[model samples]
Target: MRIHQLSSAIANQIAAGEVIERPASVVKELLENSLDAGADAISIEIGYGGLNQIKISDNGHGIIAEDLPLAVAAHATSKITTLDDLYAINSMGFRGEALASIASVAKVTISSKTAHQEHAMMLQVQNGQHVLSPCARTIGTTIDVVDLFFNAPVRKRFLKNEKLEFQAIELVIKRFALSAPHINLIVKHNGKLVLSLPAAIHEQAKRDRMAKIFGSSFIKDAIYLDVERGAMRLYGWISGPNYQRSQNDRQWVYINQRMIKDKLINHALKQTYDGMLYPGRFPACLLYFTINTAEVDVNVHPTKHEVRFQQPRLVHDFFTSQLSAALQSDGQNNTEQTLQDDSSGVTSSFNSKLYDVAGEAINMAYSFESTNKTSDVGRPYRFLEESDERYESNFYQNKLELAEPLTSQASYVAPLRPLGSAQAKKNLYSDIDECSWVALNNQYSLVFIEQQPYIVDVLVLQQKWLLEQLQQASTPLESRPLLVPVRYSLSLKLKERIEELQHYIEQLGIRSEWSIKEDKLLIRSIPIYVPYLDLRLFLEAVADLQCIQISSLLELMSQMQRFDPKLLAIEERMALNQFLLKVQNQKSQFHGVFKALSADDCRMLLHV
Candidate 1:
């Protein structure tokens, strides 16, 4: 194939494969452009899964007549020019590939008019070619994209169902809306208006806007955060400890007024929360960070959603501090009091505000009047006192209801009976004394030799089990002792200990020596029983064991050789079963005792 320059139309279509993969991608790109153009109010309309038709209208500073054609051309952007501009990029769509990419695979009509212009100009682009000139139109910009991916049959087939595609579009709109709380946004899917928000300026307004977009429940549990450290500024609302979602869809982070899915910030937020929250559950947050533009590179990606920060650690630390402070302040407040106070008057008042003007006007009129005043004069004073007394009684009753129960059925208790009990007295008089091992009511194991039961500690039994297993297994040690004497180097301290215990090691067929050059102790051989022992651990275990004086080395040998694998396994299983049974018995005992107490109390009340 001969090398030749590719045409602009072909190049744009190829770029569309990357920049405009689906309807959501197109929505994201257009929304970003609207935000960059200072759009305070934006509306999106989609039909037939954004394949048959899609329209995005923005009340922003519209493009001029000369810029209309360039806007649909690849690599044509007014956001940046010089090399230095790459580092200081503050616009959301600096690459200017969105329009060109969308125009390549769809029929696009951009009707735009600047605030200074008397009439708007419209340009129609089909299959990466301008089919119509700029015509007169209304103010602002209205972009209508129809038959998306019509030129590419393969891409069209990959498009999802209308409902799913509409959801994707909604997701993109949500990101933009979260990033720009001051912007009013409206979204329509198949002629149905799914979202509409008035312009939000104040914090409460922004919260209300978010509630309308997300849910009122989110706003209820949100914590406001605003803090600055050195060159970094952090501000936003985050969900409280008690508020969490199954996934991270609710988490939104924007850097330099551009929405980004950065993992560093997410990790920092999670770290602040620690393990107090459940795994896979994410805290809802809308975090915004502002840093010096020159200190960050925004040209790293085509979508401008990823950035390279000069000091990521600083950003992480700032977020961690702010989030921690917000959570700590929330913890200090009495949530019950706050919730009660809010529910009594504030929440009711706020809920009424969501209604129409007529309802709100009626609410206002009733809200200001003294609710305590009664129409009837004679019984008014008596009624007021009675109402006050009833309210006080109900408050106390509520407090009592909320209090923790003193005696719960779940508490654990021991099952053993006292010696003076009737059952113990009966066992004492029986032939249990002659039995070598008597099971205490089929519960406990008691060994008898001279008319007395010998009780063994459970922990001691566990240790014996481990020792038995070690003895029966092929020893996991390296060095084996030989009959012939072998010299080895050793440290001064080790040499002294070895000399003192030479007879002891010789009996086991091992030898050692002190080497001044190496300044260490070296062993020639180990016991035959533990031929593959770790030299260090074996020596340490021996030293510690030897510290306790015994009558004879033969006794020590017998003690070490007592471990047997089969017996050990049996012992361990038996011990585990015993422990499990003990725990169950104790739990049952607790329940029985609690039930008896409750019964006794009921009987006493009946007698009274």
Candidate 2:
């Protein structure tokens, strides 16, 4: 074949392949254009999951009659003019490929009436051909797209069922709605009103809008965060430890009013909840990050769902520090607040911060930033303290519940005197010896270092040990073949999912073979770590392939730790001592494990 320039239609269809993935993609682009046009009120109408027709009406400044033709022309945009504008882009539709691409694959009609125009001018593009007509309308714009993927039939096959596609479209709309609470937006699916959100005029109105979308439970269980570091500000509601999602679907992150799914932000948020949550569980977050436009690049991705920060390290560290500070002081300094009724008639309020079993607001945020104040990154993190209220009066009334029982030896250790819970003190033991250890109540161990005693909760120690073992395991853990292979009958869908995750499952030391004839899966072996757990129940619980990872192993170990350590033989006790010694040598506080008491704390607990 001779090399020649492709036709305009072919070129546009190629661009559409990248910019348009599903009905949600089209909705995103059109909504972005509406937002860029300064539309405060927008309405969306979709038919048959947006495959048959999609209409978006926005009450914004309409385009001039002359610019109507140029609007559908590729590479023609009013957003940016030069290369520098690309780096610090403020508008959402800067690339200008959306209209042209949508026109190439579907029949599109855009009608507009500017303040200067006497009548509305309509432009239609069908099969890559253009037609213009004059009509009467309001002083705004309405774009109607019909027969999506009519030119490119192959793209139509990629679409899911109408129910699933509409779900995706609804999710996109909700994201935009949350990102811009000032906008009055309504969505209709097949003529049925799915969403009707009025413009949020006050703080109460904004809270009402969020409650309508995310539900009242979220507001009740979430921690309100407002913190700033340098030029960046992170503010939003992060669900407390009491509330968690099995998947990260509820996480909404917006940077400068633009919804994004940047991996850096995701990782940073997940890192914040390091020890508080186990694997496969996600905290519901609605975070908004505001940074100077020049400090971040939004043009990195075509969909603008991802961005590259100029100083990613600084941005990440800042998020970690600010969120950590918020989580730390959340329990002690929380103030009660109520939400006023909105026009929607739904009102909800939060009276108290979510507290953990320890009676402290669960601090999921772990500080990962460097500790050195003078060595580069900046100052050490300091939490905001409430001076108005003193520490909780019931601090010593609550007992620290140990998740596991301690190993007891009457001959080798001294008796433990009852002590109340000590006020939280930073850092752990500076000096210690094995001779100063004493087991207390078969729940915790008291260790004296430098003539000061510190409490070690056995449950915390067991959980930490189990988590480390699972994470450090060499992949493809040692497996033991079963004497009689276990068989499980499963649905076709479940069988397919198991087949898909066969590779990961094997890495955890479980081997399986499919028996299509019997509609069953034959398990050949089991991982040595999870021998006690019911294999069938475990397999069913880890149905999601994403859960079949180190997290799953950790979950299994946590379950195993529930069995008493008192059952172990004397030989086992010797081995356990070596393990405990290793833990003592390595600073426990540094790893989110147990923290030892300072000398001052020891005296306070003893009433010295």
Candidate 3:
């Protein structure tokens, strides 16, 4: 075949194949164009699922009569003028391909009257030809398309059922209605009104619009999240932990007012709900993230449904941190968090060194140990019994009821006593040893200091100890290069996603290179704290995880410490006992978990 350039009509039809896949695509393109034209009031009329006709009327600044011919010309866009403009696109219809593409595949008529014009002008195009005349009566524009895909029989045959296409179009309209809550959108099907949304300029009106699209129940059970980090801001509503979805259909994420399907975003948000949700369930969220346009590339996808961030790692971490904090705090933060920044606060990075909280796991030597059961040691509050699984749940409730609050003021009456719920000078842990304590219900242990009684929650102490360990290290996890870079391949979609996550993966201590030409992955380094990647399956598993941190040795110790005394390995019990001895006299440290036995508490213990 000889090399040749395709005709203008043929080239437009090709672009149509990429941009207009279904009735919904056409609606999306036209509606976005109207919005870009600064339309606040738009009306859409669909017939036969857009196969018979699609008429869109928008009260936006209309095209000048002289530009009618250029308006339908492919590649002639008003949104961008130079390379720099392309990089920082602020308008939605920048490609200038919608009118041309729609014209090539269907019969299109554009009618408009500029505000200064004496009369309206109309342009009609059919089968690669155009005609212009004077008509119409509004200061806005209306675009009418008929017999869509009439010139492309193959594309017509591939369309979905009319009912399904209409549903898809309805969904596109709903997206606009939600994203542009301040716009008035009216829709009609076969000349019957099906939907109407008035402009929502007030907070209450916006909430009402949300109820119509996502259901009132979602709003009732959702928490509002408005947080910011430098120039980036994330604000929206997320359903409470108890309100979940069977599937992730309700997860709506918009970047700078444009809806998108993003893997990194979904993954990070899902991670926030890991333990809060049940298996096979997903959380409902309506979130919007706004960032500088220059920091992201939106032209990578044909439909502009995905974006590439300049610093993906920073963006991902920012999302995870802000969302996690809001979700954890349940929109009412009781724990004040200090956000530490290394530079201008426009960015964030995750402390993957969290794995170092369990350091021995980096060596792949951490494993669960078993032991015999210990006898029930308390009334109404049973310690963890290997055979009695029901007690742990109830015991946690008891701990909350009995544990000392952190804000209790110290009493001058007992200068030697630690900050606790109550001071009992008669009992103190100042001279107690590990062997002198009795394992009590939940994680509490009864100990004797200076021959007096003092009670402490051992589990709480272990957690505090682990935190101190991490603080001492005060460094990021180490990454060790592999002797030979691991190589592999995956589906093209997964390949592209992982490549996009290269910087993020590196922040998790993975150094990798992805080759699009061959669809291969080359991994040169892995986080040192991740213990057992000495095998191929482990390597593959780690790569597929995208990012994972090392486990802290203390996590293992905490679990074992909870085992019934008899079920615990002798060495584990000895370790716990030894730790109890260390805290025997740490009066200032147990402000929240230590309780000196009152005369009444002692009397009850003796059953007197």
User: Once model 2 is optimally superposed onto the true structure by TM-score, how far is the C-alpha of residue 388 displaced, in angstroms?
Assistant: 32
For model 2, give the 10-residue run with minimal summed lDDT.
409-418
The segments of candidate 1 whose C-alpha lies over 4 angstroms from its true place after superposition are 1-4, 115-118, 335-608
The residue pairs that clash in candidate 1, if any, are 476-532, 477-532, 477-533, 478-532, 478-533, 489-522, 490-520, 490-521, 491-520, 491-521
lDDT scores for all predictions?
A: 0.59, 0.67, 0.65
**For candidate 1, lDDT tens digit of each residue in 370-487?**
1211111111011011010121222111211101211111110100111244454354434333334433321124444344334322223333333333344332211233333222
Candidate 3 matches the true fold with a TM-score of: 0.56
Query: Candidates ranked by lDDT, best first?
Result: 2, 3, 1
Total backbone clashes of candidate 3, pairs 3 or more residues apart or in separate chains: 10
lDDT of 2: 0.67
Span of 10 residues, lowest total lDDT, candidate 3: 368-377
If scored against the real structure, what TM-score would every candidate get? 0.57, 0.61, 0.56
Query: Which pairs of residues have clashing backbones in candidate 3?
Result: 355-550, 357-552, 358-551, 358-552, 358-553, 359-553, 371-567, 372-566, 372-567, 434-581
User: What's the distance in Å from true for residue 343, model 3?
Assistant: 47
Off by over 4 Å in 3: 331-608
Q: How would you encode candidate 3's per-residue C-alpha lDDT over 140-171 as one tens digit per residue?
A: 89999999999899999999988989999999
Model 2 scores a TM of 0.61
